[model samples]
Target: MIHMAVTPKDRSHIRTYKTAKQAWERLEKLFLGNESIQSSRFEEVNNAANNFVMLEGETAEEVHRRLTALALQLTELGATFADDAWIKRKFFTALLPYEEMKSGARESRELIRLLWPTETLPTDLANLIKWLETAPDRFIDWKESAARAGADMALSFVLSWYDEVNLDQLECRRADVEENLPAENKTARLARACAIADFVDKRVFIEDPNPPSDDEEELEDEEIEMESPPPAVDPAGPPPAGA
Candidate 1:
């Protein structure tokens, strides 16, 4: 069985060993010699536990697989923590936005447990971590949709006000209305509408209707005309000596 388990390339090296014990000893000497492997494995385990981060586009399952693989390697190297809870705490702490995600995951898991009383779910920590991994995408989708709807609503209001005020030729109005005003008249209302439209356009659609442009050439021409000293007043031909 040992001979069958060994690959053909490795079998050649251990061909001299007559018994399984001898072959095992030979393999161990060739592979696990001294403390170098142990030291390297220890460093890897520490790095994994200390520096693990959830990348921007990485999903929860991917992170779980990565951490699980590291944990398994650590276990193989005979590293032990206080308990599973300690390990989990360390792992979660290493993740970005840990507290918010942890709380959200805890709530989601509780809701799932309440919904399915008899189902054989995984451990709380496991389920919570899983939820943490998967929840960001859904939350981002919801926020994006909500922002789109809000932009649409704001645009509708602005257009309605535009029609009511009949300010078809009016450009974008400045948002300078005083907060202490007791009542909003048509001008203030239109200004507020324009402000809302500008905000929604800039923030949601990333569209700037009136971006500032450099008028350096026009300014330079004006400055030259102003500074030219009126062509020396044409003194030779002027007749204002007595007048």
Candidate 2:
């Protein structure tokens, strides 16, 4: 059963194991390795994170994605510092390529400041990448635009997503609020603020920003179910990986 269950490649490892328990353990070690094995993987990723130096033509967005993915992978292995300052420091260290003391330090500061929005750097990983990818200058424009709308515009940047308010009726309601925001915006940011969260929450909605189309809705309504899981090696044994 074990021989039939695993792929041809994985079968090589399980073939030598005599019992079901032994075969299962081998498979676990191969995929979700034990603590010691995980620690070794963590050390490898940690080294990559620490030794990261920007490639000659690398954009900050690309470098940030790579470094953050590595850092997240490390955190999954074990607990570590995830404070704002700690992450920022690690990110900066990976970004700059120091050539000389004075020049490199100045260039590093300039590059780091490029990631800032208005008076402050972003406080989290997602915001940091967003700031970098959108270009800090654009964030400043968004900030100013929000400010002109109301006094508490900074809260507007607190980062919400449209999926939170993604019902079809809710979407149309949000669009109405945004359209009428100018009227409500004079007194306070309440309506405008609500509208803007859903507006800016859109990562990409240049054309319509409308809800799912009729065809899309029909496809969703008649969604196909996933295939049934493969049977276990034994009734008492766990289901295979594809399940």
| lDDT minimum window of 10 residues, candidate 2 | 201-210
Winning candidate number (TM-score): 1
Residue-level lDDT of model 2, residues 26-145, one tens digit each, is 677556877788878878878877677767667778877776666656655553764456567767786545334336445544554743423475455465556456565655555655
Q: How accurate locally, in lDDT, is each candidate?
A: 0.63, 0.60
How high is each candidate's TM-score? 0.31, 0.28
Point out where model 1 deviates above 4 Å.
Answer: 1-31, 94-243
TM-score of 2: 0.28
lDDT of 2 at 241: 93
At residue 55, what lDDT does model 1 achieve?
Answer: 69
